[model samples]
Target chain A: MATIETTGLTKSFGDVHAVEDLDLTVEEGEIFGFLGPNGAGKSTTINLLLDFIRPTSGNIEVLGIDAQERPAAVRRRVGVLPEGFGFDDPLLGREYLEWAIETKEADDDPDELIDLVGLTGDADRLAADYSTGMQQRLAFAMALAGDPDLLILDEPSTGLDPNGIQNMREIVREQAERGTTVFFSSHHLAEVEAVCDRVGVMNEGELVAVDTIEGLRESAGGPATIQLECATPPTELGVADLDVVTDVAVDERTLSVTCTGASAKVDVVTHVAERAEIVDILSESVSLEALFNDLTDGGRDGDDADSEQAATEVAQ
Target chain B: MSVRTVAKQDFLSARRSRALWFATTLFALLAVLIAYGSQGYRLSATEQVQNTFRSFGMVLAVLLPIVALVASYMSIAGERESGGIKFLLSFPNTRRDVFLGKLASRLAVVAAGLTFIFLAATAVAVARHGAFPVGVVLGTYLVSLLYGSVFVAVAVALSSAVGARSRAIGAAVGSYFVLIVLYLVPTIRITALVQWVHDTMLGMEPNPHLYDAVTYTSPYIAFRKALNLVLPTEMQQEVFRGSLEAGGELPVYLTDEFSLVVFAVWLTVPLVVGYVRFEGSDLE
Candidate 1:
């Protein structure tokens, strides 16, 4: 079942198109990442679907109900960790969790979530006294209070430390494995790429691409950057054909080339070794940092224009 | 969904807030002072009810507005600021469910606490002087809450309009003062401290016409006038007044026609306005 389906969902604040004719379908029981740069309208999109703000035009169906028309009904089935709500006050951590549990009416044992979030020891301490990482853990516990079928987590890993980030990844991945559909949005693409099975990249209020995790990487140009180390220079190199060596920069004895295809990385590395002395072997995988910069920068004008057209159509 | 649960949550939330507890407690203690601290009245059981009614009436006529302000000031604003409302709103409950549930619970707490203090004042009166007239004591406190209905609406509307907690509180408090101290200044101009300004403003010739208009135009004075009608200090006279007179008629000093309309306006206008604002606002 589709938990969320929006057709041409558009929102504008005077001249600024915050979210433009965004059409998306979120299948039940899958972790979906709404990947975008800052101000790409991830938060705005969530707010519209939650009915905190009405859409300028188009339709939003969340949890099988029209969001604008039946927000209370949709809210009943959803759980959200909103962005910028990253702060809390003097309430005790465990007590806050208990209140959330009672409010959401989720059947999970509080003690179990306490352990799951690893806050059993500091359960009585005031939440204001918690470190940023500890607070993130508490927020996670709050999101899980109701055993919600669809969880909308915005920047869930914002203040987490290194280990906390790893723990968050595990928790998110675990929820997805347990058949909960997770719709997460973040400016930090690394967080999205780590746990999200599929991703939709947006730029300037428009969704440029939506595909399986592997598919987005493939479509965005597959990763290939080779590092080599050799004992001695050999003869006869540069025989294998490489796809688009866009740029080749050299630092001391190592050469770095912007190329597509990882298999081509092996070909380049073998050839480099036959030509000169090589030191070490490394393949710079196309991390989401690289992915986002390219998409937002390269696709900004095209994405914005495309989205404005869609928005006008929805308005009509 | 249960009213009991709603009340319990409200009570707990208030208990968790030490500042709110102190502010409300101070108001209750002040009500007692208003009754006991007056000059030369016989401190008897019946007089105690009359005194408490007078003091609570005056205090709550003002304090009820404050309560209404605090209640609405925090209603949606508090939730949005703390992110607590969003968490609760995401539940199966509708906006109406959350609004009424929290409101009922908060009201129950305030009412319960006020009733206890009013009852204490009555007990003191009986122990010191004579038998208690249950009707007068109960009526004063109950009506005070009712008169405060507009304050609640105004506060709630402001809360729904903006997201800043401190700004919301300031606006509600400031607006209350405007209605009381500014527009109704001539009526409240009785204190010795303000006599100099009063002399300058009135020049020994206070205009009866201006004062009457100001009184009705001011929600605060109008509310006090409403209370004076419902519970007069003349009850301390203890005459064998007719039952119909005791239950319904206004005191000789208060004209019932205008105050009743003001009270009704306070109850309805703000609620309708606030609900409309709430329906349009972004939950963020």
Candidate 2:
């Protein structure tokens, strides 16, 4: 079953539209990354899904319940890690974890989870005494509590070290493997690229693209590159004149050519062989970077909205 | 955790804090001194001192709201400001459970504090007057406390409404001040129409009458009236003797039980409002 489905979701704050005409669906047990820039409507859309804010126009169903009409029912089955959480209480880190278990009516080994977050030592200490990272881990633990069916994480790795970042990615992967639908939003494009099975890119309050990383890369632009190293130089090789060729730069023993497509790759190899010593030939595929740039920069001065950029932009 | 568990933990946590210990010690000392120092306390001479303490001490009308604001109003907002609320709310618990759990904890602490103060006061009275009207004191204390609980509930709602730390703090304090302006003082009650619209928040009926209605409306005043009603004939005679005027009637309204009903209403109304808001609020 689809864990979440939103039809034409729209939210407005006064005159500004934070999220508009957003249509999205997440399958069960999938790691869906809602990727966007800082102001992209990712968080706003998530808020709407969680029923933290009402949609100006649209319908949302999460966990098989209407988001606005039955938020508590949906909330009971979903775990959320909000962007910024603050509280002052004397409860220990582990105590908070235990409280989550009670709230969800689920049995969880808080000690084990605490260890997973590297908060074993601080388990007995008041949350106020722990460092920000430890506290954040505590938040993550809470989200994991009750073994929720659907997990919603918003910028979950904002305040973490490299090791912490790795643990976060692993934790999400582990949950997804366990059949927990994972829907999260992040401004960290690399993180999204790494673990996300599919990504919804947004800019200026709209989703421009929603597909796998490979699909995005393909749609972004041309794939791979061909590098040629020859036995002879002095502009002897016609590397730049080929129809498929875009630009060519020669440094000593190597020739680097930018091409529109890989169609001309064979002809270039033959040309290099005829004019110079075919010492080595290297070809590389186009990266998401290239694709993202092309897809986002296609419009004139943003006159034409880039699907990926529009997906990432938050109206508010 | 169960509500009981939440309340129990709150109690244990409060016991560990220095604030509780400090406040308790002060109450103990004051109670012992007052009980012993007033041996054969006569009404006429003591009334002067009683009135002074009445206006200055914690039982003043203003104290109840202050206690509620300080203890419960800041509960959630403080957490949000420190970024700890996110951790708590992330749990599978509904916002209602979160609010109720915290409310239960604060109430337990407040109840403990009120109980201690009353016990100490009784101890002092016994030591000085040779015998204390325990029933009167106990009855009055309950009435006053029920009224105070109303503030706690409303304060919690206010705290939830204001999410940021500094702003929440200001709102709590400012609302408390507004309450005082509208509730304690009568002349100021005569205000511009806008002021009435603002003051309507104080109460739907506006406590109606101030010190006079304190019996059925105000917590401490209601408690005082109830205590006077429950006092034994001998103590009543003694109380009458100790009045500011040697022979005057202490105000009485339909016996002391009216105070209990008013206190109940005071507590029930605000709690209902808070719970309803909390159950449905977005809490973002």
Index of the highest-TM-score prediction: 1
- Runs of candidate 1 with Cα error greater than 4 angstroms are A86-91, A227-283, A298-316, B2-10, B39-52, B187-219, B228-261
* Cand. 2 Cα-lDDT: 0.66
Q: What RMSD, rounded to one decimal, does every model reach?
A: 8.2, 7.0
**lDDT per residue (tens digit) for residues B173-209 in model 2:** 8776655545445454333333355456544443222
Highest DockQ scorer: 2
TM-score of each: 0.80, 0.78
Clashing pairs in 1: A229-A278, A229-A279, A230-A278, B45-B125
Angstrom error of the Cα, residue A52, model 2: value is 2.6
TM-score of chain B of each: 0.72, 0.66
- Against the native complex, each candidate's DockQ, computed on alpha carbons, is 0.31, 0.33
